[model samples]
Target chain A: MSTAKQPDPARRNERSRQAILDAARELVTEVGYAKVTIEAIAARAGVGKQTIYRWWRSRGAVIFDSFLALSEGAEGLALPDTGDIEADLKTVMRATVAEFADPGFEAPIRALNSEIINDPELAAQYREKLAGPVDEAKKARLRSAQRAGQLAADADLDLALELLYAPLYQRWLHRSGPLTPEYADALVELTLRAFRP
Target chain B: MSTAKQPDPARRNERSRQAILDAARELVTEVGYAKVTIEAIAARAGVGKQTIYRWWRSRGAVIFDSFLALSEGAEGLALPDTGDIEADLKTVMRATVAEFADPGFEAPIRALNSEIINDPELAAQYREKLAGPVDEAKKARLRSAQRAGQLAADADLDLALELLYAPLYQRWLHRSGPLTPEYADALVELTLRAFRP
Candidate 1:
């Protein structure tokens, strides 16, 4: 064994993992979730198919993990708390609108959504692993608002988050309307009006 | 030629149309949207491939029209206008929750949604054909509420509709929450509270 030429196993493993995720994301965008296969992902990532199989159980797992990796950076995300719930919400919501509007996120998110809709198991995994954490962060902000008397103490934060985010999401999914900062602000205004203390 | 028993061409065409739609709906539910195809739909409908192509453009079109045919009976539906928007909206929204939960509608609708999320052209057609008329009826009810001094006089009806329905829709799509009649009623309450004059 040439010890001087040995590659760091940990770093190499991390590189392969990232390559697989990026390949999954790119293939989903280019050809869609259904057409994205493990073989294709392995080829695109320059890894052996066994390398992918060693990590992910199925195509859906790889795709879900691709999305999870994208949001991994935002794992610690917390909505800004400015005491003024309205302002904080608008800022966060507008940021959401901008993110959805970005070309980088558009196709992959649409692919992810389609996958989630069709596969209930993946949907469950997504809620627990992906949405669960982000929702908790947003809820913490809402709870803070409740403490500040800015929102009703009895407000169902889950429902409130849905109200605040779903309209934009539906619009984006269906292309039913524009996703503008103004639209984001309007949703925030209406949700606040709906849930006022 | 059995002229005495000749079937009318128009009636034959109508039968073929219904059979095709039923077949499309059935196949989508059975195999999911990705696996459903014109050939399967044709075989199940007992019609020729040319017949499906004659009336529809693609698999997405057929799936969308299957949904359209289901709602064709309710094309002229008007929301109950007892001058009480809250009760009327609750009634409509609860009916929606029930519809989404129905086994008869479940798989086909999920397939349709997956298709819509991935295909922009199909999404536009859905908005125009399926959602437009339904939204118009709901808007009329909101307008009546406005005239009754219930909702804000100049409320944006489109935005109001989204707030009222999108929350329930997101929950159903993500399977993130239940689609109870109580859930529907809560949306109506929060929407009404949000837009109350």
Candidate 2:
């Protein structure tokens, strides 16, 4: 017979946490960040408000965590290095474009983004949790490209990364234009030319 | 005095409208967009709520108009053509950086931007009133540059415009970094290089 621990309290706690986060994300998509309440998240998750308060400080914090949860496993946000800088950046950006096109993902992310912009503390947490990792990954990829001599030795990786991603982000946030794979490809080509030795 | 025509009700109405818009901008900066109300704007401007309702349809519309009023005299958003695309873009971008750094401009603009992103109708209106003009101006400048042989003859002006301003907009909305003049200058140079013939 296989021996098993008695229900695994830690696993149960993690499941509860996941449930709460799932509920928060759903409520945020349905009702928006401003209308999302901890009480509502708790009720939706079949947990008590104390359970939520035990983990998060405010509704904003919960929403931020929920956003991170949603972004997890999103392949587009990941920086891939497949020995070709152009192809790698295009792959990642196309994934990002696809993510932005999904209403299920876009609504909650945009709502949380608004909250982050409004609240400095939450913004800091978001940058640390979400943006910081993506930025570091992209920078690492760019540094690798430099090492491979694909980019100018003196290229500003930070600025180059912004050029790669900022146009898509601007269009996404402002609804200036469609976020298409074609647009992503154009940005990749332009960025490569700009950074080429 | 010789041509005074019963105090010119049109001019009086224009003054009241300006007062209301000014009051809306000030209140948005002070109390934030969420807390700003028609009543508050009226009281601050010494006008009645009916006067505001007579012109604007909602608080969002009022805030939108208030933002336009605030931007009326700003030199940054204007696309200047000095026969040199690099110099002109750099000048405008540096001015934009300065404008964003001003708290009075930042708070109200940020507030209005959040509202625009949240409401599609408002976002459309914002695009028409604000983004439309700036985009047209930039495109005009880029087309002129194309004629002058500064840009590729077949360069995608729309995409090129995004490359010019999107980085600044991304940094502004995300608070990803300091909105410095140096950052603006770097973007200008990168874009010029990317679009070169």
Candidate 3:
């Protein structure tokens, strides 16, 4: 039958999506966020401009999707629940430090950050699509800690998460200080003290 | 005297510098960091491009100086030393919250952040010129607290400052949460707990 010669539309669509995201991440890192265009992304992905437009409204949307895919590819970012909040936090934080320090992630992440900083719409999308899920996971871990009496029963988890993570983020953003394993350990220890039961 | 018809060289230089900085800030707020041109700044300030070049190598440098001038104009950002660390911290942090929330600061500051995030040289300049002095003042306040036995005797002051401020910065940058006085007070309380003697 003629159907035997036809490609599966769903499979083709999935591959095209993956290809577009990959092209976006590569181009953003290579050329910086401001210079990367929809046409360029389409060319790099071996797709039509219309295809890219059909999927994403702008270059920022494509870049955001790339970051979302990158996170999902990195094991869904499930925080380790070892029942020891301090240990789990240190482990996860150290991994984060390592990722931020990696050359592969450095440029693309900075590009993502600059785009997010400049564009309020993209920033809002980032919060909803990317940060929301990751933060929810971290809060789930904190709730587990609270249940185990490691943290204050009524501690504001949002503030607790901010205190735990924002210093590392600031240091990286400003290049204010080094991101080391010891730094990761110290943040966890201090945050625990702050939220002690 | 012939000199009577001419402006003082030092005063002329100072006025030109102020004009350039003012123009840079206004243009960056109006057009954003990426689109602001040396030509536009020169035109707006009624100076030549060579003049901007004579002082700064690029637009980012000009913008950094603008922020530097802004901070200097804001009373050199001296942290209050009221001897009660918590009360003083609350006052300063609330002021910071207000500043970040100000519509006037919102655009230019966001422009500054994105520029700093993308340019390493500009970021280094920002550290040495802008953040350095303000941090020293905060550290001085923290040292006073340490002397009063309020914080740990050997507390890492740099880290302590980061703990107190970075969360607020992250919240503002990410639009992840509100910048409220109560939030500022909570940061002070938690940071103090973290470094309790």
Candidate 4:
């Protein structure tokens, strides 16, 4: 019995929590956020509605958390550091184009957009939970380039990040244009040229 | 009788058409899109609902047409061309910030966002009737700059336009940051540098 470890109930609870989030994400993808409910998520996860209620305040909270989790997994998945800002930005942008093109994430993202207009509460949650983190991370990367003398010293960090990122979002939500990888490469190149001192 | 002059029925009809559009815009701003109806617009316009139906396919049509008419008035306002592309872009962007800050347009923009989500048919109309013209105008202006050698020869025109424009839309729709002239100027400067060859 020497050096043996005790089993933890906390670990079991954590597994249940992840299962609930996975079920919510799956249901949201299938039925849309308008149709997703705590009861349905609970049933799918084999947990109780009370379990969901205990953890989150609204259906939006559950969905937003799921999205953040997915994004977190994909964070820095393809951002390049080839020492050439143009090539690196293009590499990252191309990868983002592919991610946004994925059918798995498209429905969930569109669902988020559909709710942002009518529901201020959901909109706030969406920005704080998902958009804010992604924006800040990208901004940090751009700022790092600036600090490394790869970009102009006085560059507007927020605008620089937005220039590189926002067009992809505009296309995805509005269907204004094809979000192809070629489109991404073009954005990266244009922005990289524009940013140089 | 030697110099018989005709009263222009076309002029009179144009005034009446504008009056109806004004009333409809006012009503939507006051009551919101969900509560606005054919009967209500007709009552406010002091005309028959048939008159509105004759011109528009639906209430969405009326609201959208009203916005388009307003934007046409706003269009000739012009992108400032001070010879320097950076300064000119900044001037135009600052004006845009001021325009969005105006409550007269802000309410309508919110209404438009909701319409885009709640009614797909209306969204399609908005894409054609509103976004298309404005977006194309901006793109054309950017392309003119590229031809004038203000930007790289290989710059992607669409992406260049988005790089200059998307941040403002992101900020306004999300309410995440200030819609100030200074912010617009910063964005212009940043984009100009990023796209510079």
Per-residue lDDT of candidate 4, residues B78-183 (tens digit): 4555557777778778888998888778877777775565456776777776777676767666776787788767766666667777888877777767898888
Q: Clash pairs of candidate 2?
A: none
lDDT of 2 by residue, A1-197 (tens): 34374577788899999999999999988987678888899999999999999998888888789888876754355467889999998898898899889988887878887887788788787777778777887888898999999998899887887888888877888787998999889999999888888
Tell me what TM-score chain B of candidate 4 gets against the true chain B. 0.81
- Which stretches of model 1 miss by more than 4 angstroms? A1-10, A31-35, B1-8
User: Backbone clashes per model, in order?
Assistant: 0, 0, 0, 9
For the predicted complex of model 2, DockQ is: 0.64
- Sort order, lDDT high to low: 3, 1, 2, 4
lDDT of 3 by residue, A47-106 (tens): 999999898887777888898787774336678898898999999999989999998898
* Predicted model with the maximum lDDT: 3
For residues A1-197, what per-residue lDDT tens digits would candidate 4 score against the true structure?
65247666688789888998899889988986668888899999999889888888978778767766776754343345666777777777888888888989876777666566556677787677677667666766677677788787777676677777787877766667898878888777666666765
Q: What tens-digit string does per-residue lDDT give for candidate 3 at B36-84?
A: 8889999999999998899898788788788777777443666888789
Candidate 3's C-alpha runs over 4 A off are: A7-10, A73-77, B1-13, B31-35, B73-77
Each candidate's DockQ score against the native complex? 0.87, 0.64, 0.87, 0.40
Name the better of 1 and 2 by DockQ: 1
TM-score for predicted model 1 compared with the true structure: 0.93
Model 4 TM-score, all chains together: 0.73
Model 1 clash count equals 0
Query: What is model 2's native contact fraction?
Result: 0.58
Top candidate when judged by DockQ against the true structure: 1
